[model samples]
Target chain A: MALGGDARVGEVVESSSTGFVSQSYRLYGAPHLGALVRTGGPCPAYGVVHEVATRGIDPSRRPTARGEGEASEEDVYRSNPQLEHLLRTDFRAVIVGHASEGGTLYHLPPSPPPIYAFVHVCVADELSAFSASTDCLRLLAGSGIAALEEVVAAFLRHAVAAQPDPQAFLAGAGRQLAALIPGDFRTVESILLRAAP
Target chain B: MTYRESSGRYLGVVVGGSMTRGVDVRLSPDCPVEEMALGQHVVIQGQSRRFYGVITDIALEWSDDSIRANPPDTSNPLIAGVVATSAAYAMLRVLPMLAIEGEFAMLDGPAPARTVPPHFAPVRLASEEDVQVVFGAEDSRHFWVGNPLDMETRVCLDLEEFVTRSNGVFGKSGTGKSFLTRILLAGILQKSAAVNLVFDMESEYGWMGTSEGTGMVKGIKQLFPSRVGVFSLDEDHSRRRGVSPDYLLRVGYNQIEPGDIDLLRENLGLSEVAADAAYSLARHYGQERWVRSFLDVSGPEMRELAADLNVNERALSTLHNRLSRFRRYDFMTERESDESVEEILRYLDRGIHVVLEFGRHRHDLSAYMLVANLLTRRIHERYVRRKEEAMGDASREPRPLVITIEEAHRFLSREVASQTTFGNIAREMRKYNVTLLVVDQRPSGIDEEVMSQLGTKLVCLLDNERDVDAVTAGTYGARELRSVLSRLDSKQQSLVFGHSVPIPVVLRVRDYGTAESYRELGFLEASEMRRQMERDADDLFGGRD
Candidate 1:
C-alpha cells in the first residue's frame, strides 16, 4: 500500500545482511545518494542510497564516447536506439531501520528487503521525521558505506531542503550532529559548513 | 536560523569524539571565543545531566585540507588569494569537571562528579552564581583574594584552612611575592582568627617601603593600625618611618639558647668543636649569664674556662670571638627587660599582629636567624602549654598563631631544617594552633618534609625546574597545573591552589595600592577613623594655646 504520491523507481536485485542493491526502472531517475528508499511487502524496510551508477547491461558492450559537438542534448539519446535495452541504472542502499505499525525504528532491519521487491522513494514527511534524530547520520557514518562523509552531508542537505523551514531545520540538524559526535567537533563543523546555504 | 532559547550563555557546542578524560568543543560562529581564557569555567548541557569543564586548550582548524594537500592554483592569483583566508573553526579542548559519583551531574552548583558530557551538548560559560557555588561564598572563614581571569566574579580562599596549616608564598624575586604576602596578612588580620608574628627581613612588612617605580607601598601596620603593632631591632630606622617601637625587640643575654647557636653555626663559620664549646660553657656558667661572662673573658681567661669546662682551648677562643660580635647589635641588651616573653604572648593572645622589623640588621643573616629562632621557640612552648590546657574544654579556644619567616630556606633548608624550631613548627604546629607562612625565593632550597606540610601554596612565575617542582609537589592535579604555573606572567599573576581552593585557579593578583582595594580590605575605613579621632583630640587640647 504505497502512497499515491510515492513512485516506484527500482526493484531489489541483490541482498545482504547489511544492505541491498536495486536496479532502476530505466537508465534515468536513479535515486540520489543519501536519499531514503523503501522496499518490502506489508512491513517496510528503509535504507539510505549510498551509491548510484549506470552502465551497459552486457559486460562486453562498451558505449562509444560522445563529444560536446552534439547538436542538442536529447539528440544523442534519441540517436542511440539500442541504449534503452543495453544500459541500466543501479543503486546500492545500506539498510538503516524498519517501520512497523508501531513507528519507524532506528537500527539494522530484521532482514534486507526480499529480491525483486519494488523500491519507492520515501515521501518528504517520512524523510523529515527520520532526519529529526541524528541516529541515521550516525548509522551511515559508522557503516561501511561508500564516500561516508559525502553521503552524510548530502543526506543532511536533502533533509533540510525537504523541511517547512529550511534554515531552522539546518540549524536543528547541525545541533543534532553536534550531539551525535561531540568529541569530533571537526567533523561536525565540516558537515554544518557544507550544509549552510 | 531560529536559535533555541538557552538557559546559559551558549559558548559553543561539543564537536569532537569523546576522549578518555575530556572532549573537544567547536565554538559557535557567533560566540566571542576570543574573550575566553584558559581556566575559565564552562558547563555543557547533556541529555540527562550537565557536565562542567575548564578550557584547557584552544586551536583553529582550517576547513580546507585540499589547500594544503594540493599545490596552489597559481594560474589564477585572485582565486589562490581567496582560498588562503578560507574558513577556520575554533576548537577547544575541555577537561570535564565531574563529581566523585561518576555520574554526569549538573555543574550549576558545587557537587562533584566524574562523568563526561553527552555529545553535542551546548557548552556555556559558567555564570557568576556557578562560580560562587564552586569557589564558595565570602564569609569570616573565607577572604576574597582576586578574581579569576576573564571573569567578573571574585575568587576567595578559606581563611581557616590557610592559618591552620603551614603555607608558602613562593616566587622568583621582583614577582610581587611581598605584595601578595601583605594582602594575605591583611586577610588574616581581618578575620582575627589568628595572631601573626612577621619576621620583617627587608623591613617591608612593618613600615611603608618604596618601590623603584611605584611609590610608598603601605605596610600591614599602616593598614590595620588597631590590630597591628610594630617592633624594631633598630630604633633609628623605625624613627625614620615615623614609627615608635612597641617594645624595641630586645633579647636579653639569657635568651640565648643552644638551638640558637646551632642555627647560626653556618653564618658564624663555627666548626663542630667550637659549637660544642659554646654549649659546654653555657652548662658551666648557666644559660642566663654564659654569653655575658664569655664576652668579657680574655684569651687566658677563655683558656682557663675551657680547661674547667673540659673544652678545646682554640675552639673556646673561636666561640668567644664569634659570640662577642652580638655586642655590636644594640638590640642585644646585657640587662633583662621587665617586659618578658609573657608580655609578647599576652599581646598575641589578645589578637594583635606583631611585625618585628629588622631595620638596618636586615642583611645580617646571623642576627635575623638567631632572633627569629629564639622568639619562636618561646612562643611555640607557650602555645603548646595553652593547647594542652584547653584540650577537653569545649568553651576554651586556643588562639591560633602564624609565624612568618623570610629567607625561610635559611632556617628550614636541608642542612638545618631538622634542627630549627621553625621546622618543628612547620611539621607539628597545626596541632598547637601555630603555623608558618614560609616565604622564599628558592623554594627548592626548603626541605621536602616542610614543603609537603605546606597546606596552601600561592606560586608566581618560577623558571627553575626544581623550584617549580617543589611548589607543586604532592598536590592533586599537579601535572596539569604545572603547565598553567609555567605560563604565569612575571608580574602580579599567581596560581593559587591547595586546601583553601576547590580547584587550582590562575588569577591576576588584586591591586594592592588602590583606594578601592584598601577600602575592600577595610584599611581605608580603619585609617580614616583613626585620623579623625586624632584631629578631634588635637582640637580639644590645643584650643587654650
Candidate 2:
C-alpha cells in the first residue's frame, strides 16, 4: 500500500541496534512522545518516540536582554526572525519493528534506521495496525525509561484515538494489560484510568 | 467490527497469578459485582472446553497512584463520580471444578483427564444447561430440592443415593429446617423411593402449622393424604385441630425393652443404681411384663422385692415413682392393641409414609423416646430379616425406609447413642434398606460417629460454632462451605452438600405455603382425592335419609 499523510518531521541523526535519534525540521510540531514514526524503504522500520529535546543549533548563540515594551508574544517571535531556524528539536524513538509487504511485523528489525534516513509520521491506519497488539506496551513498561507508565498511557491514548471504536480499543488494551500483570491490578487500573477518554 | 464476540452477563475475564488451581477474575464494568454472592457458580468459556468454578472470595483493589495523580475533587460531584468508577477494581477468586478428559466429554458422557480451561477466558454466569449437566437432570433418580441462589436452574439431589444412606437436616430455630425436610420427604414420596416414618416431636409434620410470612404451612399428611398416615400418641390433642388419627400409637408394656428403659433413664432422673435395679426386676419378671408388674407392687412389696433382688430400696422407689408417669398416657396400655408393630411395617412395606405425631406428648421426652425407640427397634429388626431374605432372592428387594426423628440429639447423644435404635440406624441401617433422617437444632450434641455417617446434610443458619462444625463434618469442601453455611439467612436459606449434590450450594427453600408450590408438590391432587373420598362416604350414609 502506498503511504499516505507522510509528513517529513525529522531525519535519523543517530542510529543504534535498538533505537535511533532523529532531528526535527524545527521546534514547531515536534513529534509527541510515543508517536509511531518510520524510516527506511521497501521494508520500513518503526519506532516509538521515547524522549524529546530542544536546543539552540549554534552553541554560542545567546539571547540578549530587551527592554519590556508593549510587545506581545507574537511581536517577540516576529522580531527575532532567526529564532525559528536558530533552535532545533531532536527526539529519541526506540525502534520496535519493521513493516513487510504481507503485514506489519512486530519485533526488532533486521537493521536499524541508517544515518540521515528521513523520519515520517505514520498515518492513522498504519499506527492503528501497528498497535493492534499490545506487545509494545509490555516493552515500554519494562523499558526503565523516565515516566514509563506515563509514556505507555500516552501511547494508549493515541492508539485509542486512532481506532474506529475508541472505547472498545481501550477496553481491549485494558484486558491485555490485565492479563499481562494479573498480580498488579493497581498498575493496570492506573494505565486504564489515564488512558480513558 | 471487532474480531471477537462476547455475550452473557459479562462476569469477568480469567486472570493468572500466583494461584495454581484458583483463577483471579477481573470483573467487567457491566457486571454487577455487588450482587455476586460467594459460592455462586460461574463458567469460564475456553476455545475447546468450559471451566466451572465457584466464587470463593472477592476483593476490591484501589489504584493508589491513579488516585494520587488525579485526586478527586469532592467539591465537584461529577469528578468524584468519575473517580469512583475509574480507581477501584474488583477481583473474584474462583476455584475451578476439575474437568476430567475422558470422564466428561462435553455433553456426551463422563470423560477422564484433568484439564483447566485456557487463561483469559471470558467468565459468565453458569447457564441452565451447564447447571443441569453438573447437577444431574431431574428424573426418576434425581429430584429437584431447591433453586441455587441467583440461578433459574433447579438444584436436584440424587434420590437413589439419598435413600441408600442416612441424612440430616440441621438449623437453628425458624431457619426452615422443617420446610426443607418436608420438601425432601415430598421428593422421596414422589419418587416412591422410600417409605418415610416421621417421629414428629412438635406435631408439625402431621398437621398444618402457620409461618411468619406465609400463612398456613401444610404438613406432610395434609399434602399427601392418600400416601401419608398420621398416628398420634395423644389423639385428644390432635382432635382439637379436627385431625382424626388413622390409629392411636399404643405401645404395650410388653413391648418396652431394657434398652428403651435405659434410654429414658435421663428423662426419668433415674440414678445408676435405680437403673441397675430395673434390670434385675426385668430379669425376675421377664422383660415384657416387668414394668407393669413393678408398677403394681405396693410400697412394702417393693421394699420386699428390692431386698430379694439385692437392689437399693430408695433407688427402686425412685424408679417406681418415675415409671408411674406412663399411667396417665392412655396410649401406653398393658394390653397390646390391634394396630401392632407388624401393621405399621405392613403399611411401610406397601409404600405408605407414616407420621407419629406427639400431640400433647410432644415435649414429654420420656414418652417420645420410649415409643420412638421401641417402634424403630421392631421395624429395624423386621428390616434386617427382610434384607436377609432378600439376599436369597434378588427379586425380593427390601423396600427402602427412612425414619425421621426430631430432637435427634436426645437419642443420638454420646450418653445413650450406643443403646438407641436411631443411632444404629444411622450407622448400619443403610445396608438393611433403612436410613434415619435426623433433624435437630444442636447437631453437636449428636455423637460424632453418627454425624459422619450422614450422607447428605441440609444446613440452615446456625450461629453456634459446634453445631456448624458437626453439620459440616466429613463434607468435602467444608472449609469454603462453612462460611456459606454460617452466612445463610436465618429464615429460608440452607446449604446442601454431600453425596447428593455435586458441589456445595446455597439455596432458598421453595415457598412452602404458596398454592403453586402445593400444586407442584401434588398436594392439589391429594386434596382432590380426599374430596372424592368424602363424597363417596356422604353418598353411602346420606342415602339412609
Candidate 3:
C-alpha cells in the first residue's frame, strides 16, 4: 500500500538477489540518482538508485539530436509525440536491504523480486527507518560500481537529511565508511567531504 | 563517552602472559591511558579468586601496518575515537604479587601469587576496601609508617615482627636515611617490646635530627625521655650541647681486644702480621692487660720486647703505633671505667634504651668501631648468659635488644663480618634475644649473608645498580621490582619489603622532623613531658609518685 504522495516511479523489468532493474512508465520520469526506492510485492526489496539511463525502446534504433533549431528542449519532444512511446527511462538499484516480518534487515533478501514488480520512491519516514544503523553501508560500498564513491556520497546526503540528528548520523556514517573500505582513506575522505551535513 | 571514576574503575582485561614474565593487559579505549601509572596497585578478577598486582610497564600498539605508514586524520573526533578503539590500543604489564580465594577469605591474608590470572580476566584499580583488606589496619602492634604511593590508606609495619630479626635502613647519602631510621626507631621505642642500643656514630639520633624543611626535630630520647638514656663518650662536648647525658663513657686500653683491632684493619692501616701480633701479645700478657702492656714499652726496648713475644720486630712496631691511637682518644683511659660497659648494661637491664653518642668523635671510624664493638661484645656475652639462665627460669631473660649501628658496611663487610660482634648479632638473629638495625648507604659493601638475613629493609632512592640489587636480593619478584625501586623520587619515598609487610610496597615516608610529627608520636609539652616521665618511671619500676 503506497502512502499519500509516494511516487509510483517504475516497474521491475529485471531482478536478482543482489539488485534489480526497473523501467519507468513515462519517458524521463525515473527518480533522481541515489534516491531510496522500493519494489512492491509480498516481500519488498529496498535499494539505492545507483544507475539511471534513458534510451530508445528498440535495440536497433538509436536516439539522435533533434533539438538543434527548437526554442527549448520541450519543443523537440512536443513536435514529435511519438518520441515518448519510442523512448524508455530505466534504472538499476543496488539492493542494500529488505523488509522482513520483524523490521528492516540490512542484508540481502533470500530471493529476487518478481519481474515487473511495481517500484515506488520511498517516503522520508520509510528512509529514516532503513538508514537508522549504518550497517547497510557495507553492502553499498561493496557493490563494485565505477561510480561507487559518488553513489555513497549522494545516498548519505539524502539519508542524512531525513535523520533526526543529522550531524551525529553523518559522523556515524563517516566512521562506518572509514571501517568498511579498509585502508582506502582517499575514497572515504572524498565520500565524507561530499556527504558532510 | 562517559568518564569513569578511578576508584575501583574497570581498567582493562588481562590479555596474555605468564607468572615469571607477568601478565599483559590491553586497556579499553574508553579508559584513558594517561591515567595508568607505574607501581599503581591493581586487582584482577579471576575465575574463583582475585590476584593483586602492580603496573610495571605501559605501551601503545596497533593491528595494521598501514595505519602507521599512512596515519588517519585523528583531528576529527569520530575518526580518532574509532581508530583508538578498533585499530590502536594501550597495553600494560602488571606483576601480580598476592592472591586470595573468595572475598571474605582475607582473614588468612593474601598469599604470594603462585599462578597468574587466566587470560581476559577483568582488572581494576584497587579500591580503598581492597587496600585495607591487604594491608592490615594500624593498631598497637602495627605502626603506621607511611602511606602507599598515591593513596591515603596507611601502610603499617608489624613492629613486633620487625624486631624479631635483624632489619636494615639503606639509601644513598641525603636520601632521608637518617629520618627513615629515626621513624623506625621511634616506632620501636613507642610500640615494640624490644629495647634499642643505638651506636649513634653521627650523634644525630640522640637529642635531635635536622630536616631540610624543619630546622631541628626531636629525637627518640626527647620523645621518650624516661625510657631512653643518652650516653656520651665526650663529657665536655655533651655539656656544651646541654645534654647532661645520663652516663659518660671512657674505655680503658685493656678493653681493646684483638678482634676489635681486626675490624679496624683499614681504619688503622694495620698489616695482617701486625693485626695478628696483637692477639699473641694478648696471649702473652693475658687479654685483660695486653693492649696497655704492649703500648707501655719504650722505643729502645721494642726489639727485645718483640723477641720475648716471638713476633716480628717491624710488625710489633706497627702494633705499638696503632695502639697509641687509643691513648689520644679522651674516652680511652689507662684503667677501665665502670661508667662504660657496666652503666650501659644497667640501662639495658632496666628496659631503658641506650643511645651511645660519639660527640666530637663522630667522624673517627676507629673510635666508633672500637667503642661499638667493645660494648656490643660485652652486651652479647651478658645476654647469652642471661638467656641460658632463663632456660631454667624464664623470668631471668633479659629484655630483647635491637642494636642500631650506622655506617654498618665498615663493620659487616665480607672481609671482617666474622671478626665483628655486629655480624654475629646479625647472623644469630634473636637467638640470644638481640638483633641488629644496620643503617648504611653502601649496602653493596655489606656481606651478602647479612643482607639476605635482614628481616625487613626500608630502602630509599639508591641509583647504584649493585646497591639496589643488594637491597632487593633473595626476595620474591626482585627482578620485576627493579624498575620501581630505581625510579623512586630522590627523597621521602622508600621501598619496603620483607617480614614486616605482607607484600613489597613503595611508600612516601610519613613526616619525621616536624613538631607535629613529634606530637603525633605522643611527644608532649614541657609540663606534660615532665608528667609523662614520671608516668613512665611508675610504669617501669612500680609506682612511687
Candidate 4:
C-alpha cells in the first residue's frame, strides 16, 4: 500500500478513541476489543479510544514473537515515514493475545487500509470488563453517547467471543449464544467489519 | 280643758295662716322639733289638707311616730283612741317642698298627726315637654309613647345612651321583652335614617321588615334587589344531623378561637382532638380552590375528613352543614376575592334593613361568633380599602350599619364570656364605626364586660327583677336604676338613656303601627307553630276572609 511519509521523530497522534470509548461505553457497554484479541479470530472487535502509538516498528530491528502464535522471521516492520500516514488517520488495529504454557502474550497487528476480518478481540475484552458492574450499567444508561458506546463495545465482545473458532481461548466457555447484541448478530458483524481495523 | 293633763305634749301647729280655719290652745310644755314627711296631710275644721298646704312656712314642733303611737289618754278612757287626736299633729319631714301651699296656724298642744290625702286630680299622659327636659330635641325625635312619662325622668335609665353605641335586649322567656323591644326598634327605624340589621329569630320581624303592604315599602330586598334576603330557620333551610351537609366545610372554615373550639366540642359532642382536627380541616378547605365541592361531601365523609385531621367529627360536620344553608339565601352569594364595599353600599342606600337574621338556627356559639366576626371583618376591609374620602368626605359618612341582635345574651353569654370573638368585637367595633343594638329579656345573662361596652341604652320596661337589676346596676347606679326599673311599666313604656339622649326619660314608646303590637296581643293562646301558621295564613289571606 502506498504510505505517505513525514518526519520520523514526530509525536504519534493520540487517538481520541478513549473519548469514543467512553461515549460508546455509555452508549453501549464495555470495550469488546480486548476480549476479541485474547480470543483471536476474524472476530468483531470494538473499543472507543485506547492510546494510539504511531512510531511504527523500526524496519532494521529484529522481530520477536511471544505466546502461542508460531514465531516467524517475517519483515513486518514499517518505517517512520509510513507511520506518519497511519498517524494522521484513524488508529484501527486487530489486537490478538496468545496465552500458553509459558504465559500470556499480546500481539497488535498493522492497521488494514480498510478494516478486514482479523482478530478484533482486544477491544472486545476490555469492553466486556467495563460493562459488568451495575454502576457502569447506570452510567451507560444515562451517559448518552457514552452509554451507547459502552453498549456497542459490550455487544462486540460478546459477538466475537460467540464466533466459532478452533483457536479461540473462550471456545465453549459457556452456553450456546442464543442471540447477539442489537438482537441481530449478522447485522452487527457487518457494521463492525465495515468500521474495523 | 280636760286634754291639759294628757301625757302627749303640745305639738306646734299652723297659726294664723291664710288657709287655717282656726287655732286651739295647748296643754303641755314646748316639744323638740323633728322633720316632717313630704306630702303628708293634716286636718283642721272638717276638710283634710296637707301640712304644707295648711302653712306656707313656719317653725313647728314635731315628734317621732313612736311618740304618737303611745299618746297618753287625756279624754275618757273609752275615748282614749278618740277626741280626734288633736286634729293635727306635726309630723317629721325628710324631703324639701317643691311647690308652695297656703299657710300654717298656731294651734294648741296634741295636734293631730298628718295623713296623705288622695288628690282626685285626673291622671295626665306624659307630654313631649316632660320628655324634652331629659331627652333633648334631637333625641326626643326618637322618643315615642305617652302617659306618666315623668316617672322615667327621675331614675335616668337613659336608653338614649344605649342607642348611640347601640344597645342589647336580653331576658328569659315570656318577659314581654320582645314586645318591649319592638316598640323602640320600630321607633328608631321609622324616625331615623340609621340602618339596622335584625337577627329575627323565629321569623319575628319578617312580617314588619317585608316590603309588601307591610310598610317598609322602601326596603332593599324589594326596592333594589327583590331577592329573598330574609332567611328562615325552618328545617328546610337549616341542616339536620346526618340529613344536611355542611357548607362551611365545603366552602372552607375560618380560624376558630379556643373558646369557640370548646363550645363546638361541648355543644356538638366532640372530643377536643376532633374539634381541633375539624377546625384545621376547615381552615385548610378554606384555602383550597376546590372548596365548594366539599359541600357535596357526605356528613360521614366530612366527619371523616375532620377526623383525619383530628377534628371533632360531629362538630365539624354539623357546623359545616349549617354554614352551607346560608349560602342558599339570596343576599348571600359566593363572595368574590374582589367584591368591594361599593357593591354593598347600594343595598344600604335602598332603605332596606339588611336583616342578617339568624333566627331559630342551631348555630350555638360558633355561628354567632363567626357571623359577628365576619361582619366586622367585612366592615374593616371596606374601611381600609376606602380612599380616605378624597379629603372631602369628612363627615366620615360612616357606612351606617346597625347590627341589632334580639337575644344578645346568646352571643355575649357569660358561658363564652371574654373568650368569644363576639365579645372582642363587642368591645372593639365601636372604634371600627360599627354599632351593636343588643336586645334580650335577661341582660344578666350577658357578660358584664360586653354589656358595659354599649354607648347607648334603650331600656324598655323590664319586669324581671334580676334582669332589671343587672342592666340598671351595670350602667346606672343601683339606687336610681332600682327605682326606675321597679316602676317601669312594660306597655310601650321604656326609659331611654345614655349618650344618645340628653337625659334618661321614660315614656310610652311611639307606635310604628307595625304588626308587632298585634303579634304581641294575638300571640296569646297559640303554640309557636300555630302562631307561625297564623302568620302564614295572614300573609296569604291579606287579612280578608
Give the 10-residue window scoring lowest on summed lDDT in candidate 4 chain A: A169-178
| Model 2 chain A: ten consecutive residues of lowest lDDT | A61-70
Instruction: Return the top candidate by DockQ.
Output: 3
Best first by TM-score, ranked: 3, 2, 1, 4
Q: Interface RMSD of the predictions, in order shown?
A: 9.7, 6.4, 3.2, 71.9
**Cα lDDT for residue B200, candidate 4:** 54
Maximum-lDDT candidate: 3
Measured against the true two-chain complex, the DockQ scores of the candidates, in the order shown, are: 0.06, 0.14, 0.25, 0.00
lDDT of each residue in A40-122, candidate 4, tens digit only: 12321222223222232454553333333434323222222243332222222222222333333222212311222222223
Q: Which stretches of candidate 4 lie over 4 Å from their true place?
A: A1-197, B1-131, B138-164, B170-176, B191-193, B209-274, B286-345, B349-352, B356-380, B383-392, B395-397, B414-421, B461-466, B474-476, B512-545
Q: Chain A only: list TM-scores of all candidates.
A: 0.86, 0.86, 0.94, 0.23
Candidate 3 per-residue lDDT, tens place, B387-467, comes to: 998895757888889999999999999999976888899998988999999999999999999899999999988989999
For candidate 3, what is the lDDT?
0.85
lDDT of 1 by residue, A1-197 (tens): 22325679999999876788999997877888878888875667788898998888986978777636679868777877777888899999988777777676777777778999999887677787776665666667668566776777777778777678776566555555555554444565566566655
List the candidate numbers ranked by lDDT, top first: 3, 2, 1, 4
lDDT of each: 0.77, 0.78, 0.85, 0.39
Estimate the TM-score of every prediction: 0.70, 0.82, 0.84, 0.42
Docking class for candidate 2: incorrect
Decide which is better by TM-score, 1 or 2. 2
Candidate 3 reaches a DockQ of 0.25
Higher-DockQ candidate of 2 and 4: 2
